[model samples]
Target chain A: MNFFACENLSAGYGRKEVLKNITLSFEKGRIASVIGPNGSGKSTLLKCMGRLLKPSAGCVYLDGRSISSMTDSAIARSVGILPQSPSAPGDIPVHCLVAYGRNPHKKALSSFTKEDRETVEWAMHATGLQDKRFLRLGQLSGGERQRAWIAMALAQRPQILLLDEPTTYLDIHHQFEVLELLEKLNTSCGLTVVMVMHDLNLASKFSGRLIAMKDGQVLLDGCAEEVLTEENIFDIFRVKSRIVDMDGSRAAMYMGVA
Target chain B: MREITDSDAKRRLMTGAAGLMLLAAGFVVSVITGTVDISVGDMARIFTGVQTDGMYHVLMNIRLPRIITGAFVGVNLALSGAILQAVLKNPLADPGIVGVTAGAGLFAMAVMILLPSFTHLVPPAAFIGAFVTSLVIYFLAYDGGAHPLRLILAGVALAAFLGAFMSSLTVLYSDRVQGTVNWMAGSLSGKSWIHVKMILPYTLLGLFGAGIGARYLNILMLGDDVARGLGLSVERVKFMLTMLAALLAASAVSVAGLLGFVGLIVPHITRLIIGSDNRFLIPFSAVFGGIIVIFADTAARVVFAPYELPVGVVMAFVGAPFFLYLLSRSSRS
Candidate 1:
């Protein structure tokens, strides 16, 4: 079943609409990556899905219910979103940061329950941050800090997690490490993952499904082999690219400008 | 995998206990040391109901009320600063930055000048001015939401505007200049039990509200978008917290006449010692703030002897340099 979907969505910063009549949906446990050039509204679309941005038109639904009608805590329990370049206050330890994700599960005056502790531990362990849990976020490298943020989101224990440009500013190894972590979470825990990816090759390599957007519309949406075709790459990104199959995954190697 | 551990909680509790002790010491010192120099023996005799004529008058009528007022004002201002810093997510954000102090000062001055017959209404009037100024800054800073930088900018702008108007009033009413200047310099001079009574309800209400909202403040420090993703009603929480902070600052201003630096410095020092968890930060800041103000007020009363400097003057002399030092240290780090 489609656990999440947006219908006839339009959104923008001001008067200029960046997303126009965009409709999309995702099945319960699938991993979907949104790939597009800089100005193609990929982040905007993710923001709309995360309820960070209210759409100018149309509604986002979770489990066939309009998300706008749900309480903030209810939506948070079902959907977790990490925007690009997420930041915490100065020198906050990883454990403390991760513990914040349990905010929705706890009451205003209540202490952390046994279940809250267990969930935070599980989140920290899942992100391979158990060893670094006590370290301040500022003390970690770029990749470790990213994992710390991911752990924070995981502590929310949402049915679906959405990340925008999660791997930006990371070295290639750290980038793959983050994607692999997400893939593991997707397969092992049945967590639905949606992320915006600028690297077409990595998006195709890791994501089970890819949606290519251009000019505020979906140019192509399918498996990597279907969506990362030479013509689609040229059409969407205005870049000439060759698609090579490495193992079973398709890798888009860009040649030059189209 | 890692828990908060027993030691961390114990450490925080110990810190709080120590802070309370220091506050007690400061309160005692404030009551004891003045231009007339009452001894500990005199204070003990007075408390034990000996009621020596001169000492009784001095302790009950003058010193005790000032000390109580100073302590409460410190707590109010410091807690307000802590809340503002957390809600705005800017360390530099304070009651002074957001025009609460200036607004209160302006209204209080206007009352002193224009409505001298209704001098009793000054505290409430100052509160009204403070709330209105904060609301103006909140709305002006808001495009769709109140960004920290915009709030700070709007506050600075409004504070300057209010300051100009206050200066004009002071200049025009030269005959009233002495009283107005003392208040503008943030004096706690000649306060009676009536002044303490005036601010008590507001201080209690503001402190209670701030204590309840402390947890939400922790979430707010994580940034607005993250707080929303964590299921916090960001805008509503921000609005309520800002209003609470304004109430705290306004109450302090009304009683103490705009004691500066206690709010800004106390929170930073508390955060440094106990860490940034608002639950602990708020209470610790309250105690430490009380300590600082009690000491500062005592120094103000005794330092120049008969002349009597305003506690605000003493605070500025100390706090301005400390603020600059903190700014440089933070930038370097």
Candidate 2:
């Protein structure tokens, strides 16, 4: 069964409709990657799906229930979102930033329970941030900061995680590290993952499913092998590419001789 | 990265302890100094409502009211600055700097000049003016609920306008300007128990609002987009903090005139000394501010004796240079 579904949902900011009538569903325990060129409304779509942005029309259903009827905390508990470039003001400790993820689970005057501490520790461990937990965020490198943010989202312990360009600022090694960590979480915890990526190859390699968006609408949605086609690439991104079978896997390598 | 040395932690603890002790000392010192200097023993007796000739009147009336007013002014100003910094997401966005204090001061001046008999109406009028001015700034700065330049620009414009109006009022009505000069310039002199009584309620309310809102402010300092993803109602938090900040500022202005720098500098100082956790910063900033203003008032009185300078002037004299140094250092960083 689908864990979350968006039906004919249109969303935007004040008179500018960024996301057109688009429909999609995230299944349980699957890595779904949304990929498109610039201005594809990829981030907007993730925001809408994550319930960060209210849809202009239609509805989002979580476990077959209307998302609009749910409280913010409830939605937050179910879906964790990490937007591109999540920045806190000067020198927030890594542990404190991660602790904020537990805010949804906490009430006023209540201390962090044993489970909360364990989850926080688990999140730190998963993100490879255990040793740096006490360090200030500003003192960390870009990749480290990004990992700290991911650790914060992980601490939310949500069933679904939505990331908008999570690998943007990282080096290639760190990008793969983060992606690998995310993949492990999806596999081990049965957590449904949705992420937006600019690198078509990375998306194809990491995600089980691919969603291609163009101008606030979903253009294609299928398995990575099926959707990463030459025709789809040309039609969606206006890029000339050849889909070659490389070592029993489909690879779309761009050619200058279009 | 520098090591988290044992001395570093010890030094921090020592500084925190010193800051607290200084605040307590300031309070005691403020209680003792007045037209007639009170001994520590007599001042203690006065608190118990015991009668003594020389120091008793000073303790009961002059010094006590001034001390309370100074403490309230300090706390209100600091919290106002802290709240504005959090709401506007800029360290320089103190209520005074953003024209809220000027707006309140101008309105209070107009009230005294035109509607002198309605003295009770001054604080409310000043509050309304401050709120309206800040609201205008907020709207102008907001584009789909996020405004960066508009707040600073609108604040500058409103502050200029109110400042000009105050000057114009002083120019147009010179006779009414004497009381206006002293009041607008800010003085604790001639303050009575009634003034203390009037300010206590507003100060208490502002403190309560700030205490409740501090956690939200800490969340907000994570920037707007992150704050939203963290399930903070960003717009709501900003609105609530803005209101609370303006209320605190307006009340402070109404009581102590335009005591500068307490609002502008104390929060940054607190941030530099400790981490920017509002839970600790807010109350500590309140204390630091209270101490600064009380000492400033004391200096204002004692430095020139009977020809006492306004406490606001004393604050500006000390704060402006410190603020500039901070500005230069921050810019370099």
Predicted model with the maximum TM-score: 1
lDDT of 1 at A85: 87
Off by over 4 Å in 1: B1-14
In candidate 2, which residue ranges exceed 4 Å CA deviation? Answer: A247-249, B1-12, B41-51, B97-99, B116-121, B135-149
lDDT of 1 by residue, A103-148 (tens): 8887777899999999999999999999887777788889999998
lDDT of 1 by residue, B181-275 (tens): 77766778888998888778867887788888988998888888788889998988998889888888988888778778888998998998878
Q: Relative to the unseen true structure, what is the C-alpha lDDT of residue B79 in candidate 2, on a scale of 0 to 100?
A: 90
Angstrom error of the Cα, residue B311, model 1: value is 0.9
TM-score of each: 0.96, 0.93
